[model samples]
Target: MGNANQRTQLSEHIADILGTRDQPACGTSRLAIRKTIACGSMMMLALNPAQVGAVGLGEVELKSRLGQPLDATVPLTLREGESLPKNCVKPAPQNNSLARLSDLRVTAPARIGPGTYSVRISTTNPLHEPMYELSLMVKCPGATLLVRQYVLMLDLPGMPVE
Candidate 1:
């Protein structure tokens, strides 16, 4: 019975991402999953273009715990010259400083391209979410640039990777 429940839970989680669990997938990132071989709530960035002010600048969908749309930002950390796609939109930025006392909701668009792109999502307290000193690395042809870090709390218990 326990095993069955686990399987059911897993299925539900997969279905939730696939949009069979609740609301249909909406927004560019979710919709583009079919176009790109690699697509999901999380993306890994690799390269960044020069003369770019912000990378991964846009809005992303965040479903409520019940699988409904809840405005949320897909926070990003970029290296110098590493920036998000332009025209991205999201909910107004929240002052995460007061996150402990209340739900600080925010949102940003998911970034797409040939560079490594990723957003931090987790449940740990906001203070531990790396609000500062977070930036993506851009592997240029001859040099690597670090874009300014823009932290957004999306996933619970955030996970870090290179």
Candidate 2:
């Protein structure tokens, strides 16, 4: 009984944070609140995988400057998916030798505590087009969600890589 009450309170707290409460449309507000609660539940579950169930959250897409160290913090409740990898994020093999990715890995906010995580990588050279593929994963129960982002590495003038 107490656990259920606590869960409800937590859901309400998360709903407030997500701005899903007190809307004009009651039906839509309920649905949005429900989704927010589910996301909050996922965050909690991800934080304590051993005690709860799954250990996955969501996905996000990011863009950065070319020839510079890429550091990005993406929210976990960005999208839903089906699979993930052993590591949260990894660099895919690049076909173009002129543009390459190095030192790719997950950095700070290692755990899924704040519904966000950070990734870092160093890109070298310039591509014909401003695009690079980055692989990301989130672990869930019995499955993992895999997301691929075509990061747009913008080429700015007077940049080191340019």
Candidate 3:
């Protein structure tokens, strides 16, 4: 982590220009902005990395439903080819059957709120060996209805709620 004072200074500088100056004082708003930005940053980090504990060769790609571009950070194992055929490697069928990619849908509650999120984790590379670890992150800010509602309230004041 960067120095707190340094980050705060940078945040305050940005807030001075972009943040609201009507209700709260600059200093107060600066702190609030910094906290908000920090929280959002943390949320991104938490959902970005999938494999934290295990050592293995695997690559993860995240994509939106619209086929938009998303961030990709391939694990070091993939580059070395050490991960292939074991971490990334699939088992060959005994009777000349082909190795196939499989997809598994894991639904876990969003870190921010209610409603289960459907995350489809697909892999062309197979984890043939036992205990091959891989983690995938979902940094879905508007993934939760509650979060969307909260943001809507901030954006649209006195908006009807049902």
Candidate 4:
């Protein structure tokens, strides 16, 4: 939502500048400015489509197990057909899913699990910032889902007293 607001503000600012700047003060100019800003906004959004939940306030949380791939869709949004750098893939005791950002479709680690793990993924891509870390919490596959369901149930009608 905040990103939407930011995009709106950016467009408005651009339009305001274009309207007031050295351009001709004519109706045709106004139409062109609006169209330009609109196209720019759309392009920006399209290029960032993979940035769904990637609100990188630093550490992103994930869950995984040994031999299972990590999920990297949170902290990193890669361009189409891009893969993680070699250094991004690490050995156990510090396993991660960031490596899966490429063709794995499963895009995390080739070998991981055992317990909670964390690893930082660095990127030189101008779209994503320099780097960010994923705090991977390891557990039985259904455990997290069960906990989530229990939490949702607790929030149901008259489930508990405040």
| All models, RMSD in angstroms | 23.1, 17.5, 23.3, 20.1
Global local distance difference test of model 1: 0.39
Q: CA lDDT of 26 in candidate 2? A: 65
Residue 28 of model 3, lDDT score = 65
TM-score ranking of the models:
2, 4, 1, 3
TM-score of each: 0.21, 0.37, 0.20, 0.22
- For model 1 the TM-score comes to 0.21
Residue 23, model 3: Cα distance from true site in angstroms:
4.7
Pairwise TM-score winner, candidates 1 and 3: 1
lDDT of each: 0.39, 0.50, 0.34, 0.35
**lDDT string, candidate 4, 1-162, tens digits:** 999999988987876655643445686486777878987999987775431221111233433322333333223332334333323322123233332232222234331223212333322222121222233222221122111100011122233444
Q: Could you tell me the lDDT of residue 50 within candidate 2?
A: 41
* Candidate 3: pairs in clash: 50-135, 50-136, 51-135, 85-89, 86-89
Q: Which stretches of candidate 3 lie over 4 Å from their true place?
A: 1-23, 56-162
Say what the RMSD of model 4 is.
Answer: 20.1
Worst 10 residues of 3 by lDDT: 145-154
Error of 2 at 47 (Å): 15
Residue-wise lDDT of candidate 3 within 76-159, one digit each (tens)? 221121111112222222221332223433333222212212223433443342222333332322221110000000112244
CA lDDT of 33 in candidate 2? 70
